[model samples]
Target: MGLLVVAALAGACGYTASARYQPSGATPSSGAAHDPTTDPASATAVALSVAAGAATETYRTDIGNATAAFVADIGTLQEAVDGGDIGAAKSDELAAQAQYDTFRQLEGGNAVNASTLDELATEVAPNGSFAGLHAVERDLWTSGNARADVAGLSVQAPVAQYLLSRDRLTPEAIGTTAVSELGWVVSTALPGREERFSHLDAVDIAAAVGAADQAFAAIEPVGRTVDPDLTTSVAQVFSSLEADVGSLGPPTQVPDAAIPTTLRLSVSQQVDATAAELAQLAARLAPLGTAGAPSS
Candidate 1:
């Protein structure tokens, strides 16, 4: 590849504009370049391109750290249990729950197999009947499903979770994904009590929305410049949805499920509508590379 690039450059070198030299022995036109000039719009486009890369990396780093904390919490809980300290084990497990909320940042983002944690739980773990985190949730929180191997699952599960953001996230993937996730949080994940076993439905929804917030913010600076009205609308939609979800209750509170029906439906509708606008913005800028590439 290096040799090919060098050869290509060598082949194309002579075409570069030269002083007092003209192709076909003709005079240069008035269009001949003056000192390189910057068009504000083109400069914005280039900046947006760079921002896309930075934004994607930010998501990657956030998810990576959250996953690490989650795994460590699990390990700590396991050690507490092995030492026969039930109270301490429970404390660590509770701390792990908080980490789980952060882990949901990957929901609908990547690697979880579904858009939301609830749907992800519907997917069975590799060679196992239990799905994603719910598999571990059952063993830890519910009495009937205790598994001696729950601790071992901590490591394997995070590997999958970590890759979802680390491997799959790119600015390009943020397009409709951010809106789709928010919609799912309000529409599907919340009402169903997605984390029924752990009883973290509210936590999951809040975390999921917060994750989408990061994603939207990542693109917002550039996106706003590219399409002012669309970008403003997108930000407003997200803030409205976030406020609604946050107002639902604290992370520790169980989703009422019944009371929020009216509000949930409203948020869901808004999300669907807003997502279309952001999709247009994403298509316009289109990030800078394929998701599988370096994204710059």
Candidate 2:
């Protein structure tokens, strides 16, 4: 990509703006005058808003592409398994595994970022971890009617459990932390690296959102309690993650029948929504100077 494109993308990913406010010795109600020129809190909020927006977009895009690829692989494996073509099914599974490995690389070690979530989604896509699951599904499909069991039930349940855990973190927390980090980085980190804020992209945004969603989803249901508002907010974050992924391609399928259809749909919807929200957020955040205006 050209420098402009790269900068735009970077801005969308997680670029931090310069500090707008400087500490002043003046106290507002005393004889001293408060300097409105440098308001740290406002500057920090603007920086965070931008980071959150960019991260959300990047996460959504990556997830969408990864999910589509995974679904395609699952379909291929299912067809082979249905036709009793074990060799073909295994080959498909292998391909999925390769993709999963690539996904892991994208995740890197930043568990709190959207990139990590993108990696996780790629890892669990039907073609990835779920590839071998088709074998079990095939068996269930071919067996005589014993119960109304679905194929890949056992395999999918665990995957869903994992997903649920990953989506437990609240979006507010993720957004807040990401922006805060960006502010700190810009203020304290090297100036040369500060320019990277202009190069954030959709992929980076999606990755950050994905990581946050995963953290939210991972909360234990027993001891963890989410308020209705928080749940709604988190759900929005999840939607953004799925949306970004969806933008890259089609919905990915889960190989295991044990995974609930409702859960899958819910997640897919969240990803799509999250992607849209993130894009908007990025646009809003990218235009601020070190400290121009407070984000309403």
Candidate 3:
């Protein structure tokens, strides 16, 4: 729904969370002796233990805190529109968009919240595919009659978008979802007009990557335990990806000449490479491996 807190911006300037590291019990890559007759049940238990710990403790807290912030921003946007002050509405819309950049990304790929919000946006906005932030953005950015006080009156759609995931959000599920969202960013959102109405592709791209990082953080310890080389590679690649996106400046302005588009082609290539690494990591962890691949 919003940032993990009002304290700092994870997306706006390519802010990053501190990486949490845990020691790996068995170092398999060093030709270390394997456990004698590894039991299937024991392996399963370990995986489940890892997932449960990550999901419940880290992932849940991040998403839950952000949800509260997003809900509050939504209220601000609604109030501005209700007042019929286009100036105030524009300011609130931009503020709301900044938060929505991260909120939408937190959902990962085609989440129920993302889909529902589109319908809700259409219900209260002009013709288009994106009805949420973009819809309200149109009224703020456009000229003449097109720029009017328009936004969904109800916050139900957005509220649901950020909160429903609490009860049963497995780290494996979230990891896969994060990979899917990242794939889209490289293949479509970054190159294309993701936030066409707001011209905020840079913002969205940064937010999407940040969201992936959050999901990846939950599983990083497990990844390192399984394959330290692979985990290290993922971390390096992620650092590069964030730096590339972060350099694009803010959503309100055009990107640098080097990255005339929201992201440079080289940046897109880096994402693909990162996806391959994540796919390998996920395969070792769970069936979520397929999510890192481009959709057929």
Residue 187, candidate 1: Cα error in Å is 5.0
lDDT of 1 by residue, 199-257 (tens): 66666666767766767787676566555677788788877777776666666555445
Cα distance off (Å), candidate 1, residue 257: 4.3
Where's the lowest-lDDT run of ten residues in candidate 3? 287-296
TM-score of 2: 0.28
User: Model 2: how far is 59 from its true place, Å?
Assistant: 1.5
Clashing residue pairs, candidate 1? none
Pick by lDDT: 1 or 2, better one: 1
Candidate 3 RMSD to the real structure = 10.6
Displacement of residue 208 (Cα, Å) in model 2 is: 17
Each prediction's Cα lDDT score? 0.54, 0.36, 0.55
Clashes of 2: 60
How would the candidate models be sorted by lDDT, starting from the highest?
3, 1, 2
lDDT tens digits, residue span 8-100, model 3: 221222212223322123223345365311232344434534443554356656666556566676677677676667677666665555455
**Best-matching candidate per TM-score:** 3
User: Least lDDT summed over 10 consecutive residues: which range in candidate 1?
Assistant: 14-23
For model 2, how does the per-residue alpha-carbon lDDT over 1-296 read when each residue is reduced to its tens digit?
34455456435544333355322222322122432212324443334334434444444444345545554665676576567675675555444433332233222333432222222223444654422332332333344321121134223323422332232112332333333322322232212221122111222223434444443342212101212333455456766545644453321232223334454444445544554443333222222222211111
Rank order (by TM-score, best first): 3, 1, 2
Candidate with top lDDT is 3
